[model samples]
Target: MPHFCRIVKSGIAAPLLAATLLLLPPAAQADHADWHHGLSLIDKLKYAPDFPHYDYVNPEAPKGGDVKLSTTGTFDTFNPVLDKGQPAVGLALVFDTLLKSADDEISTGYGLLAEGVSYPADISSATFRLRQEAKWADGKPVTPEDVVFSLDRSKELDPLYANYYKHVTSAEKTGERDVTFHFDQKNNRELPNILGQLQILPKHWWEGQGPDGKPRDITKTTLEPVMGSGPYKIAAFSAGASVRYELRDDYWGKSLNVNVGQNNFGSISYTFFGDRDVEFEAFRSGNSDYWLENIAARWATGYDFPAVKDGRVKRESLPNPLRATGVMQALVPNMRRAPFNDERVRQALNFTLDFEEMNRTVFYNAYTRVDSYFWNTDLASSGLPQDAELAILEEVKDKVPPEVFTAPYKNPVGGTPQAGRDNLRRAIALLKEAGFELKGNRMVEAKTGKPFSFEILLSSDTLERVALPYAQNLKKIGIDARVRTVDASQYTNRTRAFDYDMTWIVWAQTLSPGNEQLDYWGSRSATEQGSRNYAGIADPGVDALINKVIFAKDRDTLVAATKALDRVLLAHNYVVPLYYKRDMNIAYWDKFSRPAELPTYAIGFPTIWWSKNASPK
Candidate 1:
């Protein structure tokens, strides 16, 4: 349940559920008419009402030792949901979600903080009944008031969450532990599941005073430890360097069938570094227990250290077959700017970069060139729109690019010097068509003589490798592209505000696409500050298609609508297509043991893997 689109670093009203909370009882063997223990999006629940622990977990996995990890940025606060400061990692371990997503299946969730959840045939609303045992760290039972407070406050605080919960109009207490959410629209499947993904907050704690003897404000950032029903709490920390969470000895839900073999760590710690090289070095030198490597060059050659060769450190590539698909990993140009406003100008920039040559020279030839906004999935548009997808696109033929109907969209190709030259020539022609002319090796507006130059803002110095090469390529095409690398804080602030001309961004997608599409490309979000509409997409066709996806009647319609939307987004060229590797690159210390079959969609690292030693000492 990637509940929302993560910037590859990493759903709104996405009727993402299509059946997000569809509870089909084995005994009943029919449609959803009553509440059940498990929740799913399929015709039948993956785990039956009387099912034991999940199949992917070790029912008796020992849990004692700690796991150490690394993060490459500084954090100023523990309030992750707030828009204010950089929230520390490991905060997720501190809070319990209303439901748990199934690893083997897609768009399914099981009650975690709540014992069970109920929804109607129309899916206009969902009611969650908290477990009697669910309690905050301070020993307060999690009530309907807490659940209501969580939903109302989250939408009020962040625009991202606002877009996610836009259709959800109100929440109220029905029964003793029951909290009900009413929706503004009907049949929005994703609303239930994303709401199921809600991390229940403690209203009693936040309404009270902090350690400093002042009333706690949920809207503000804070370093004071939070009270939660989850298995971990802040044990120790430095302001911006490190944070450690100790497993709660009295965690309320340890015995819950859904939590079996999970939360195995006695303690979990995250050490922060300012650089990836330093972070990798720390993981290599045994400062940390595991390393989920994302850089291809490092995975190819950086493991020359002795530990990797020896049995001490293990390097393995895990494939996530059930992992959610469709990622636009690209240098996204801000559409609010003058140069990027023209479709031809954007296409010209896409032709300038040589991804194949870059892959051969820098990426170790490990990745595949991404073509579709939703690549590696059935939902991605292919050779041509046909049948249902074609019909969906024809509705707003005028609002979208004509090529979306007449021709298939593909990135301009380049590998050799000749191919690169040919692409640049095409780029030149496109620029000319867009009323820009090459003069003295500088691209400028042909009529007014306004120079076209923009900076590619980047957060990590490590990404400088990719940006620098692309910028050099652009320079060859008479476009002055400068690369500027800043610290994490500045990068976060700038990107959130959409301040750069272009920046490396990753827009991740799940199998079930819904309301979050509006947040990504909606017309209203384009002008709204802090919205994720990074490319400034404001097309009525996109909005209509997005609504189609959100309100898609069935799974087939959702897929077709998603494909139509993907086809339109690509035809417009919002981001310069980048590359992606399917297998997860991971290196870890050989000190832990895990289930023989891991979750199909996730690695289930420290959370599910227990130390072999099984000793806190």
Candidate 2:
């Protein structure tokens, strides 16, 4: 029979447990004492240099305990189609991805449901084979039907998901154990990575609503799907407040070596808070076990906990994986708007902001000033290119000036200033030459009655803290800049729909940057709502160049094409490159630890684990 354990109410450590223990008989009280003391043993292990990578073995590792989790912001939905964070956290234990990047070098899909997937020579089609032993949480066979249902449902539910599924023309079931995906494009370079985001929902549970409830579809069908081939299944959920997932005793993929290190808890419970102060208090008083420090200032100076001084809390700053973004933040210009439509105006805007000052003053000297849109990475250009490469970039040279491309913004007084006051003067002069003038302290186009007044949206706490200094610089240039703050959900909605005038955004232009460049600065992508084209950029030259890069079969050609594209983007000043954070700030309870062999990519959690003596539920 399944063991019956008390459902520990969600929040900070409960005082009721101690009172309940005192009321029990002598033998029961002794057992309760042992359990309480055993749980406290976690503090002893907290001082260990490293935590065990694999700690979820049944019988080998004790089971039937809960792992309480707390995070800021509640979820409105569990569907990944609309939500990115909540569903991802829940799905990490409740659902398995087809392909997962275990480390920097490999992309593995050691069949939880599907054994292996491969691409053909043409690179247009991919074939997947299922592991014979894979089964759903309810002990039913997981077949190709479930995969197709998930794909179709995702696309039908939201168009944003359809954009992600655009490459796959169709998902065809070859046999009971085999399936194939045909892409519309020559290659789906990030196909495996994309697959990791597509979690399978049970067709059986989804066809009809379960007891816990499900989302209503366009057809007015309420679908509740809890069936999935993962380590755990949702036992109970409180809409946005909290969610409880229980470990599946007869999990199909348990024996696989890949499954050993992840999903360590018997039951994983998550509680959400809308405020940072509340979340911090929860962490300080020992409610939340882990915290991913995104705010630099908060990480550097906010905490002076006794636990930290006493070495009971561990803190480490790790690098952010380039997968999230090439650069953390950038100033994007609306190319669709006039004056900014001119190449000179765009280049002038880029020259106006002094990154060096912004880095030192605004960032508290914690960041590296960025030059290229794709910086530091191999995709970025090192020096002047050869004849053929120069020719391609030179074709668009007439529209842009050499000074704009090569020279740094000149200042009247020596030394770099964060706002670059002299650069702002040059920018104003350039706009004036391009039929723009300051009217009542606002930059307006002489030909058109349009004013250069725009809004800048940001979501990061650190960005919010430092954005004022940057805003002041724009004001100095006689530009009307409005800074708007929003939560993660609102931010996602605003950016996804291309509903804002201007914004501070970042895209990690990784090592093998792909042709999705079209999405950010291309004509085709601008027409589509919710496209990554934040500034409504629509350049024909940019589109053609992106196409060339995408089709280039050879690695050298691809590299050269990418460099050429980067130069074009820089010269056009599509995005004003900002600064990159050199340090990664992460803090957690001392009981947790990670391995020494770190990957080049930022660690997102596949490599992290807890010590044996961690708190028991």
Candidate 3:
């Protein structure tokens, strides 16, 4: 899967909800003596401490050969913690996390750098004992100090990490090889598993003087690859154009059970192209080894090349079996801006989108309309709120839109010309209600006569096709909506600063939605720079419902709370919901061999695959 700053669950499997939380027996709860080799937020772990290898990997797979992949956009930094620059793809390969997630499970993680983890019954603090054999690339033993420094430094340097680790009070070295993370509150079962996702950094390498004899700053971007303790190390690179990672033959954990069948390539190289079109051309010309097709139009008609015909290149549309299709990709209207702040205006904008036409024409009828913020998931509210969901919403009825309880939320349907005209009339009436009147071809303020105009900021030209049609619809209402395409870095900076009237944004959801919901829709994050609340949502109803979601006591309450949040957010029209596909379209060369059954949650490419004819380098 491609790396987005925001964490998202990809695939169509039902997410692990509150109901999936394991309930321990009385005897098990009574004894605090037994420590665990892994942690899970939902289901009980499937692997034992002495388990040899994961079910989805070939333990005896040979490791050699090179796999060349292509990526769009340029990366100027090798640092993964910073939010500003585009970090190199696959940088995670060079760093080790304290615990590694099993791809087949929704919420289980086995110890990677840590040998064991222990927590009290109340789950306030978690203690991890570092593996004695763990060592950095520079041959320094991985220590408790490194773990503590990583947590504190990450929280200080990145807002995402700060929000993710907000409840975590401090990480202290309890023993020579043991580190304990203290939390401000207890009973957040997800916290321990989330902490396992921490990508540990070598404190000594980062704090030491660089080649230029200057102290290295963790907050700044650096092209000189820093020392890491993972299976691969940066061998060579051409700044933004390309980067190659050479496998560490003497890696300490290569033979570990969690790593036996993974990182099979001796070296992995990523070549960057300016855009998807050029990248596709490079792949077709045999310059790149793999490509994950995202464009429906291209997927339907662009695979007639000679390589594919000759069977050298393969195309596959695989089913995502690990997660529910939970994504809200939309034209996010910045509520902080004028006109958009008005609920009537935001609602009117949604009336103008013709998703049915877009899917049929541009998408080759490959996508389904995204009706809910939590689309294709149990968390999505369907029909009108009822039962437990209704009970939750009743408390906030006075504060939310009345229609949230009275009518089911639905996007305006438009397929034919007549349907489009009817929807446009409805939109015009809503705009008129919001104090705007169509004057000839321009919608202007009724009193001051100021033209209603805003630019739809875009990062890729591929989106121009989708935005241009939407702009045409907005133009019908006399709204001067123009599409402006910029580079990825510019788009990242502008969106991070919340400096646009309207822009394309995606909020990816996970199986167990927890504290991250605060960063996504919390009032505090609305004003925070580099926050993910792109719509600038700060509703009291949303904030209250998010709390309900964060501190939900059981599966039933969590489900009800999540549905309530979904209903309120949909009612607000913060974004014009777009479309999503249930399947992942991917293409790769035929030189690699993979397990018969892939992991449930991920593509498991590169990680659980080996070259057909290769040996250890």
Q: Using TM-score, give the best candidate's number.
A: 1
lDDT of 1 by residue, 326-441 (tens): 66678889999987999899999999989999899999999898887777767889888999999888888878889898899888888998999999999999999999899998
Question: How do the predictions measure up, each by TM-score?
Answer: 0.95, 0.78, 0.94
Give the per-residue lDDT of model 3 (tens digit) for 1-617.
Answer: 11123332111122222212223321122124345788765567889889999998988889988899987778899987887787888788898988887778765778899988777778777778899999999889999999999999888988888887899999999888889888899777667767877889999999999999999989899998878899999999998899999999889899889998999988899998878789889988888888887789999999998888999899988765326436788888999899899988998999889888998889999998888777767888999899999998998887788988888988899989999999999999999999999889999999999999999998778788899999999998899998998876788778878999999876667666778788889999999888778889998989989888877787788889899899899988889988878778888878898888888767787878888877744
2 or 3, greater by TM-score: 3
Q: What is the alpha-carbon lDDT of model 1 when measured against the actual structure? A: 0.81
The CA lDDT at 545 in model 1 is 94
The C-alpha lDDT values of all candidates are 0.81, 0.56, 0.81
* lDDT, model 3, position 45: 81
* Model 1: how far residue 265 lies from native, Å: 1.0
In terms of lDDT, which candidate is strongest? 3
A best-first ranking of the candidates according to their lDDT comes to 3, 1, 2
lDDT of 1 at 491: 80
Rate residue 478 of model 2 by lDDT. Answer: 74
